[model samples]
Target chain A: MIQVIAFYLFATLTIAAGALTILARNPVHSVLWLIVAFFNAAGLMVLAGAEFIAMLLVIVYVGAVAVLFLFVVMMLDIDFAELRAGFVKNFPLGLLLAIVLVCELVLGIGAERAGGIQLGTPDGTAATAAGASNIEAIGALLYSKYLFLFEAAGIILLVAMIGAIVLTHRQRGGVRGQNISRQVARRPEDATVNMQPEVGKGVQL
Target chain B: MTEFFQTIGMTYEWAWFVATICGILLIALPLMLAVAMIIYVDRKIWAAMALRRGPNVVGPFGLLQSFADGLKVFLQETIIPSAANKGLFLIAPIITFTVALLAWAVIPFNSGAILADINVGLLYVLAISSLGVYGTVIAGWASNSKYPFFSAMRASAQMISYEVSIGFILICVVLWAGSFNMGEIVEAQKSHVWIINGFVANPLLFPMWVMFLISGMAETQRAPFDLTEAESELVAGYQTEYSSMSFALYWLGEYANVLLMCALNATLFFGGYLPPLDIPVLYLVPGWLWLFAKIFFFFFVFSWVKATVPRYRYDQLMRLGWKVFLPVSLGFVVVVSGYLMYTGHFA
Candidate 1:
């Protein structure tokens, strides 16, 4: 009963924060609300016994991506007035999308309920014998049964990384990148020249 | 009504409540005390190495220095920068300290003494420790300062890079142990002659142990791998804008993480809480004592290194992690896995 209550509380907080993230007028406030939403989502994941996913959500999303979002938002000169103008213009479409999303989520939940879908729970003997904790089970499946899928996912990520690099590759004349070969080969004579000049003779070599 | 009350009394689950409370307290109290002692020991060790008397005035050899410092921090006002993200800035330290403490839940002090003896104990530790980067990142992002932001970016990149090699090394350990259970891993080691005793068939275990120790040192951001808090370069790094108790939390979190890494290193390789002995009679010395001895030895090594080695350059650190450690660990994993498979030693 307490677990149910805690789950409901976290679920409510997640929904509220997620809603506020989109609905807030201020971008900074929206980002803050998004972070809260992410945290509550992580809490929900934990309650569902998906600890690895929960941790990944917090560690990867909150730690890196959300932080990057926060940094960019904080540093950029964002004109709220200009940003808000689009919201006013697209309110109908936005509302339509929101309604559709809500309906889809409700439908999904209803479908699951109707199907009597249950998450697997291991018996104590099996758990002990197999050492099949949530993480262990997931790891076993990921490495063995779904190894190809896992590798494919990794490959896709690698492709995305390469794509991102290619997209962002810029050759600017003003900026200099380190040239290791040149640095290694350069001699002291090339770097410096000792010139001796006679005292009180400015023009003398 | 009297029968009802008796029935209720009979059904009461006081043990469950008591156990939960004890578990929480077990994690909390030692963590708090350890943090305090870590601070004192760090200063004393550094001071001694630098040829100075370290904190001599507080108590006997300044044993009470950490307590005094804690009190002072608690008394001091927390300064909030005007342009800072107030919520994240305020919550970052708590996140850091809590995450650091939570990783201890799976760490076994001795056989069957862990708060949670989950089968994925090693994975849980890895996951929890990885989450610690969030606190640093949040602190940097929220501070609205350039230095903190740069420090956070550098720290996140460094941590993520090192974590890959660290994970690889952990995989090697796990492969050898053939179980993720930390206790089982230690027990497995106990069944064999000490790797250092020259009677062992495994020559590769020592190299893996060294790799794990080095990776762990990097993961904890200790010298000479402490680019995250390179004072001359980053000016206190992610906690640059923090003050008083907030600053104290970051400090505590860092040391706690270092200790956790040391404990993990002991558990994974150096026979955890198992003493180095082949004599069956010497097993009477309680595993907890052995664990403590091993942990402190690693802690001493950490301090010794910090005192002796110069910090690596940022690029050099990155080069070592990505170019050297990552490839080596990856190759080691492949070789170990193949050997284990061929020998029919691992299932």
Candidate 2:
């Protein structure tokens, strides 16, 4: 009963935060709302006992991604008045998209129900009784059954990394980039000069 | 309803709730006080190492100096920058301070003195500690100043880099112990004779411990890795514009994080609260005392390092973290995992 209440509380906060992220006029306020949404989502993940995922949400999404968003928004020259002008123009299209998205979600739920899916029901009570914790069960499945899928996901991420590099590979002159090989190969004498001033004003030493 | 109430009354669940609440409060209050004292101790240690007298006039051995300074900060007016993001600027310190305190909930001071002895205790600690970067990042961004913003960016990058190495090293420890529960890790250590005693036992484990220590120091933003707060460069770094109690919260939170890191190091490597000897008479000394001793020892070591070593340059720090620590820790994890798998110890 307590778990149910806690789950509802987190879900409500997440939805509220998501709405506020869009509704807030100020960009910084929107980022703050987005952070709140991430936190509540992490809370929901915790309630589901996916501690790893919950941690990743808080540590990576809230800690890194949202902070990056805040940095970008703070640094950019964003005029709220100008941004608001487009909202009136885009309102009809936005409403249409929202309705279509909601309809698709409802249809997804209906299809699952039609397939005789029993959400949150155990396949077999004896499976849980077989001396494996949730983490262990998930680990077993991930490594044994879905190992190829996991490796494929990693490969896709690697491809995305290369693509990002290729897209943004620019040569800006003023930025001093590291040349490790040259640095390692150069001798100290080549980079530094031992200077002795000739004694023009005094005596030569 | 009467029967239900009676059954609820008869059960000890309320006692558990009350006990948990009291435990949490106790952890919070003392931890804050301890953090304050740690600042005084750190200053005194630094002064002593430099052959100078520290704050001695405020209280006995300058004990109340932190409190006096804290009061001064409390009375000072908070200055919010005119161009800053008002809401985020206010919320940043609170987020940092609260997250720092929240991590203490799962830390086992003694055998069973933790507020909540959750099964995923170590993972929870890692998760919560990693969230501290948000506070630093937000403070920098909200200030709308160049110094704080740059410092925050440096801090975010540095912290995320070291955290990966730290996590990999901790995975080696967890693989050896075969459990994420901290209590079980300590218990596992108790069953084995000290590995350092024999040459035949795993010699590689010590390097993993060293990796954890280094990564932990970096994570806490202590000296050598304290590029975030390098005074000469960034002018107090992310907290430059903060004043009054706002600044004090950052100060308190930083020290609290250092203490947390120290406690975690003790728990992971130093056999936690367990004393060195197994003598029966020594068993009477409660486990919490041993834990306190170990934690203070590490805290002293941190201060010593801060006073002794010069800060690392940004490039040097980054190189050490990624090129040196990451690969070393990753290799250590693979070796340890392979050993455990072959030995069937976890099975």
Candidate 3:
């Protein structure tokens, strides 16, 4: 009974927040709503007994990604009228995309209801082992069964990160950069001089 | 606890609900009191380091200083800036204070005495800590002010930068413990290095502990890493525009986060709740007391650093997080994991 209540609560909030993400006028509010959507989805994951995935969802999406989104959106000097102007011009494309998405959702649900494939249930071998926790079960499957795919995914992310860094990084000839090691390594001897001079006599360079 | 409630004639679900509520109160109420006292303790420690008396007048040795401040804030007007985003401005401080308290759920206060003994306990901590950035970010943006906005931007970037290294550092600990469960991680530390009761005693892990300590400080936005609230430039940073109870919330929440970081340092590196030496006679002292001692020790360290070390410049702070800590921590992760594999520890 509690599970039913929690599922509905999470599901309702998720949909509401997702809707608000698009409907909100302010871009910052939109991002905040998107975070709310992510959070509720994570709650749903937790209710499904995939606590590890749920926590990862919160950590990666709501924690890191949405924060960047918020950061960018907050700094944007937005023209509300200009934004709304584009909405009318882009309506047909948006409507077409929405229709395609709706069709895909309907077809996917229809296929699931028609028993197109025998996806395993919760009580099957896919369920966590009798004594093992969620993380251990996932780890066993991920490391043993899907290790190559996981490593490939990690490599892909690394490549993307490096590509971004390389594309954005720049060197300017005139820019002075602090070498922290050199700064730390400097002693009174290397960067300084002690001299005694008579009156009206300047120290030599 | 639920079972005890069940014996009181409640249904299992009701018993569980009641037990959970009781558990939350048990942790949160004391946590509030502890935060209050910890503020005073932090000030005293900082004061002693500076060779000055701190908060001596409010109560005996200024014990009631935090409470007096709390009452003062409670009675003061909550001034909302005319230009500020009203709803979000109000919500930000609450978010800060609540998120600070939220991570304590997974913290094992003693053996068999955790609020939420979930499997992914450490992940939960990481997740909650990550949400902490939102408070500052939201407060910064919502205030629609220059200084607070800049502070918020610094905070978001600083937190995200440090979190990357922090995540890798935690992976090393998780690898060593072989479990994400906080209780199991604590248990794994017992007799970790011969008679030593901590992972810190291991030569391999000692560096990780140091990095984790520094990252933890940065993550909490304590002195030396507190670029977000650097008063010289950004005038209290994100809290510049805040006033009254809203301001007080940030103050309390900041100290609470410091305490939480202290707790994490104790739990992850120092043997959490275990006696420093694994002697039977030491077990006579309660586990919670030991945890408290470790927490206070770490808190003192935090206070000492705050009082002594000068603040890091913004670029230097970023340099430390990215250039220095990031690569080292990431390399340590690989080294630690390889060592574990080579030693057949996993096998």
Worst 10 residues of 2 chain A by lDDT: A120-129
lDDT of 3: 0.92
lDDT value, residue B304 of candidate 3: 88
Best by DockQ: 3
Tell me the tens digit of each residue's lDDT in model 3 across B170-269.
9999999999999999999999999889999999899989998898899999998999999999998999989999999999899889999989988988
Q: List the residue pairs that clash in candidate 2.
A: none
What overall lDDT goes with each candidate model?
Answer: 0.79, 0.82, 0.92
Steric collisions counted per model: 0, 0, 0
Candidate 1 lDDT over residue span B96-180, tens digit each: 9888888888877777777777666776677776777778877988898988988887777788788778888878878888777
Ranking by lDDT: 3, 2, 1
DockQ of every predicted complex: 0.26, 0.46, 0.87
Evaluated with lDDT, which candidate comes out highest?
3
**With candidate 3 superimposed using the best TM-score fit, by how many Å does residue A43's alpha carbon deviate from the native?**
0.6
Find the candidate with the highest TM-score and give its number: 3
Q: What value does the lDDT take at residue A92 in candidate 2?
A: 100
- C-alpha lDDT of residue A52 in model 2: 62
